[model samples]
Target: MIYSGTYTAIKADVPEFFMRKFIKLERIRANRESIQKKLNKKWLTCGIFTCVAAIAMIGSYRYISGIVKVSSNVNGKELPIYCVQTDEKKVALSFDAAWGNDDTQRILDILKEHNVHVTFFMTGGWVESYPDDVKAIYEAGHDLGNHSQNHKNMSQLSDEEKTQELMSVHEKVKELTGVKMQLFRPPYGDYDNAVVLNARENGYYPIQWDVDSLDWKDYGTDSILNTVLNHKALGNGSIILCHNGAKYTADALDALLDGLKEKGYQVVPISQLIYKENYHMDVTGRQIPDAK
Candidate 1:
């Protein structure tokens, strides 16, 4: 405006040219202001849209996560809980320790370094053999579960034998670490309907893994890693089975944790991963909450 006013004062020297320049500058100024106003309004609209979308996303996540906390039932049958039906990217790592202690301490050290706590289902025999390992596992804040006494298939055992298998290990763990084991993973992952019923009757929650790392097979570390991370069942609330005695597991531990974390999974214990009561299992072995 100041430039325009100065030009206007010198308009008498070149009237037509100065008038034309004045009009052109005024038009340019008006257009710039108009475009800036439109841009400001557009930015305001985008801000509102972003806030609304974020709120909607949070609501959806909560609604999905609420399903796992709610418990459901299926027709009086004692079903083993395999995985939880949740939208959270959380997963549980369960180790069945029924054999050698060669890799136990190494696995524990790796877990400690990563700050990831996993569940260890120890047999009575493993506890008897590696009493200090049991104490160390408990002291390190990992979940202790009953993996039976002799590592025999629960399906082949009578009800009394099953009870003994569970109780013997539970008692030994309690004696060793003062931690009572309530989660049971049947030896060899072998369990029948009766086994499930017996476990529940004995106040233990039978757990099964959806993602099997096949660490028990003693395959290479790469194979175990590929098996788990590539498994189709790898998803939210997935129970992953590993072994404390696997040759490759200790070597694979850091990479396995990194892969799971990179894929946005929070490794938790089975005790924290599963529902204690009021839940039902779907035919696919996924645990769902009872519909309200």
Candidate 2:
């Protein structure tokens, strides 16, 4: 009986020991699975962070390069016809008429006496205030060019506004004089690429000046004469700027014409001086004839 009882106890102890060992092994496996999960999650987070940083770097590079391209384009900006490239001893004298009509007849008489015709860029208000002067200028055999309607800065206008500014004065001049003007000068000498391109699209040649008489300063007759005569930009194909509204432009007109003639420069209108077709403008805004 004693031996049988001892064998039974040993068998019972063996099964209990095996069951405890199996429980311990299961606990270890569970702990190992938890550690592996944590490691996988940490690695995934690091990978995501690295990818985000790389994407940010690429975006910054593109933005900086885009700025560089814009600046480069500005370097080669569009320009108007400041002058012409020609070997002829000819120049153009242009008068901007935005205000006043007191000296209009005097100017016409002086021009007729000199047998010289010049370009007159008139604003819409001027045309309205002095229709007879417009007719007088055209009748006297001069080029009537378009100065923007309201005398606003053309560079600041929208595309449609720019076209309106040009065509408004154009239609007014056309109706008054029965002349479709092909020349346009922006108010305040202000322009951008849109201004120039829109003018061309509307059948106009955008004009600017190389020689400024500074007659608008109302200094005196001698100042106007001295400025135009001694201007450094006075060379072949120079376009001179004057304002008829100035206090002394009419007074200085006769002497200025005589001075220009003495210098052996034939003062012609802008139409005769500029090349209408097959021409290109350089960076200095000089119109150049293309190779034949």
RMSD of 1: 15.5
Candidate 2: C-alpha lDDT: 0.89
User: Candidate 2 has which clashing residue pairs, if any?
Assistant: none
Each model's backbone clash number: 6, 0
Best by TM-score: 2
State the local distance difference test value for candidate 1.
Answer: 0.86
Tens-digit lDDT track for model 1 on 1-292?
6467756676787778768887788789989999999999999999999999999999999776565444233454456888999888999998889888998988899899889998999889989999998989999999999999998989988999999989988888888888867899988778778899888889898888889999878889999999999999999999999988888888898999999999999999989888776566777678876566
Best by lDDT: 2
Model 2's TM-score against the true structure:
0.74
